[model samples]
Each structure stands twice: as structure tokens, then as C-alpha cells.
Target: MAGLRPTRQRIALAELLFSGDHRHVSAEALHGEAGAGGIEVSLATVYNTLHQFRRAGLLREVTVDAARSYFDTDTSDHHHFFVEDEQRVIDIPADSIVIQGLPDAPNGMEVTHVDVVVRVKKV
Candidate 1:
């Protein structure tokens, strides 16, 4: 946790993310929660912290949409289920999913990661 210093805002954000069961939340949603909890943090700060956390490997990014991004505390390799209509994200547990070899890497290129975001709409 060297890189992950628990700033007041970060601590509050972590509490929001980890304190009450696991969840996948977007920056806007987190900002709203922080506001409700009386934590004064701007939406940009929330986004910056999320990006920093992701870079520090403390959180994972779920590409749910171009305009909005979801954050996951579970950093392990896995997939996600994104409900477009509901604007919700849920984890696809590691044990419940599997991945075969990835497609061949282009010449002189390597596959750093493979993120699978399964988008679905409620019926």
C-alpha cells in the first residue's frame, strides 16, 4: 500500500467502495454518495482518485461506457456484466468464468490485458 496513501478523501472513498459489501460504482455515483456522507469532494477529484487507484492496482476499471466508467475493488483478472439500461455493473466471479488463450499478438506487440465487458439490457 506504499503508493496508496489513505488521504481523507481516499479513505472516505474506500469506505464507500469497501465498507458496505462489494460493489461496482461509477465516479458520479461515488461523488453523490460522498456528498450524502458529508464528504466534500469534487467529481474531478473522484475521477482522479479512481484513475490513480487503478494505476496503483488497488482498483480495476470497467469500460461500461465512453461517458462513464465503473470502478471495481477486486483487482484480480475477471470479467463484468454491465446493465446498460440500469447503468449498473456486477462482477463475474473468477471461479465462474474462464478464458482460453488470447488472440495472437501482433508482431513485436504483447497483450497486456483483456477486459471483457458484457453489456445487457433489462427486458
Candidate 2:
């Protein structure tokens, strides 16, 4: 699902993101995957394409830390289980959690959405 014209690089990135089941991936990981798949694309291009896709409502970005973010192929409302050891994210069903008593937003601004990332560590 692309809002702009299908450029070659965009098409390639889209294939990597959407060709399989819904999942999350970082730009660095996706760059590696593209290389392994014989698709030559720069890391910068991957980041740009991911942001573009997010802006176009084709993907959702989950920020795990200030230095790391994962682009989720599932754009629907859902929480996540971030496994620290594996460095992977798995979907937590949207209906499994409920939010309550949210304070009002500032004037002229609205809450677009809320993301819940529950960190986990294997014992």
C-alpha cells in the first residue's frame, strides 16, 4: 500500500516489509535482509522508505528506546511484548489491555494513538 508512485527502491523495500506475515524490523536488520536477499539498497534509503511508509499509514513505528525503533507491518491498534534477550517484538492482542483515565491533551493537539511496550526478560 503506497501513496506515492512506486519507485524501484520503494518497491523493493515494500516487498521486504509486506511479502510475509506481519512482523517488526529495524532499519539495520532490514538492510541486512535486503543485502542477503540480493537487493542492493542503502541503509539511509531503508530508513527513509520506512518513515515514508509510516507517514502514509502503511506501517506503525514502535520506539523501544531512544536509540532503537522497530517498524511494525501490522498497522492496527495493538500492544507489544519486547523480549530483551532476543531483541524481538511480538504482538499483544489489542483487546487484552485497557487504558483508563487519560489526562486531557493540550490545546490544539489530540492523541493520535497510544503504544504499550511490555518489556520481558527470560528467567
Candidate 3:
């Protein structure tokens, strides 16, 4: 499991996040889910926990725009499909696409990983 101390709140949120199939969640949306599930928690708490989880390598943060972000439980190497009409994120396996463009990293720097978000909308 993740290395953080097993606090009650963290445990509850982790259950909500990892118990089900891997999926993406925004803080506000997750806070709503917690409330509906009868878990007493706050939005700020959710945000903080999410940041902690990201730092701990338990979740991957995906930013769609300045105003919205999502935490994905599936931490494997993969890209994404941002479904605009539904405002949701879906996983895209990394091998399915080939990236051709290239720019060398600056001296003393190296690229760790790449994140690709393909925006899609229904016509």
C-alpha cells in the first residue's frame, strides 16, 4: 500500500478511490461521493489528501484546464482521452500511439515521462 500513515480519513478516502475499478476523479466530485457515501469530510481535506497521494505516487494528477483537474488511480504508463461533452477522463494505453516529434532535453535535464491528453467531443 501507499507509505502514508493509516489515518482514519485517509483510509476512508483510499477505500473510495482504490476499491473500485481504476477511474479518474476531481476533488469536488470525490468530495461529493464521500458525502453521498456518508463519510463526513470536507472539500479542502479531499484536495489535501489528493496532493499527498500524488506526491506519494499513489495517484496521477491530470490537468484538463486551469480550472479543472483529475486524479487517476491507474498509475501505469498510459495517455488519456478527455471527453469534453461528458467532462470525464478515459485511459488510453501508451502503446496504441506513436509520438514522432522530438526535442532534446536541455543540458543537465532529462524527460522522465510524457502525458498526452487527447480532447474529444461528440459531433
Candidate 4:
């Protein structure tokens, strides 16, 4: 529905993605799921599909660090909490935080969105 071609692979991936409640998933994890679910798809294909989905606004990419990122199904305006120990992501209550800043956008550029990822480790 995000203006992407409904290819067989995309359809399968979309089913896996949107079947349950909104969640976060990494490419590797999704590739593994597809593999286990008897879907003959390659890792590269999964990555490409994810990027395509993101470009089509079907997913939101949340980069937790330089090496790890996850695709979030919920696209609403909200931040996330990255569980460091579990390597998972969850939404932070939208009303629980407030942000104030003192910076202006660069010439000809406008601030589009702000992403806040709070990392919490096991106590």
C-alpha cells in the first residue's frame, strides 16, 4: 500500500512484518525468520526490500549505533528506548519526555524530524 510493487517476495515480507503488533526488526533477524519459514530469499534481497520499504514509507529505520540498526513498523511521531542488554527497541511514552534546543537549520535546509534513542542496560 506504500506505492511499492506487490512482488511475491515483498508480499511475503510484508506479511511477516505486519502480521503482529508493531515491532522492530533487523535485516539479519528477518532474513533468519524468512529462512526458517521456508521462504527462499537471500540476505541481500532482504536488505534491498527493507530499504525499498523505508523509501516507500512503510518502515522507519532506527540506527542504534554505528553498526546496528532496526526497522520499526510504527511510524508515528515518537522516540525509542534501546534495551542494550537484550538488543531490542521499544517506544518511549510520547508524553514522558520533552526536548528543547537552540539551533537553527542551515541555509536552505529545514529540520524535518528528531529521533531520540535512550539506551538502557540491565541493572
Best by TM-score: 2
Please rank every candidate by TM-score, starting with the best: 2, 4, 3, 1
Model 2 lDDT tens row, 1-123: 566779888999899899999999999999999999999999999999999999999999999889989999999999999999999999999999898988899999999898999999999
Query: What is the per-residue lDDT of model 4 for residues 42-122, given as tens digits with 9 covering 90 to 100?
Result: 999999999999999889999999999999999888899999999999998667778788489999999977889999998
Alpha-carbon RMSD, candidate 2: 1.0
Better of 1 and 2 by lDDT: 2
**Candidate 1 lDDT, 1-123, residue by residue in tens:** 437777999888877877866678889999999999999999999999889888987788888768778898788878899888888888876667677977999999999877888898988
Stretches of candidate 2 off by over 4 Å are none
What local distance difference test score does each model get? 0.84, 0.93, 0.93, 0.92
Of candidate 2, the 10-residue stretch with the lowest lDDT total is: 1-10
Give candidate 1 regions above 4 Å deviation: 95-101, 107-109
In angstroms, how far off is 120's CA in candidate 2?
Answer: 0.5
Q: After superposition, which runs of candidate 4 have C-alpha atoms over 4 Å from their true positions?
A: none
Candidate 4's displacement at residue 117, Å, is 0.5
Deviation in Å, model 1, residue 32 alpha carbon: 0.6
Worst 10 residues of 4 by lDDT: 93-102
* Displacement of the residue 63 alpha carbon in candidate 1, Å: 0.6
What TM-score against the true fold does each predicted structure earn? Answer: 0.84, 0.95, 0.94, 0.95
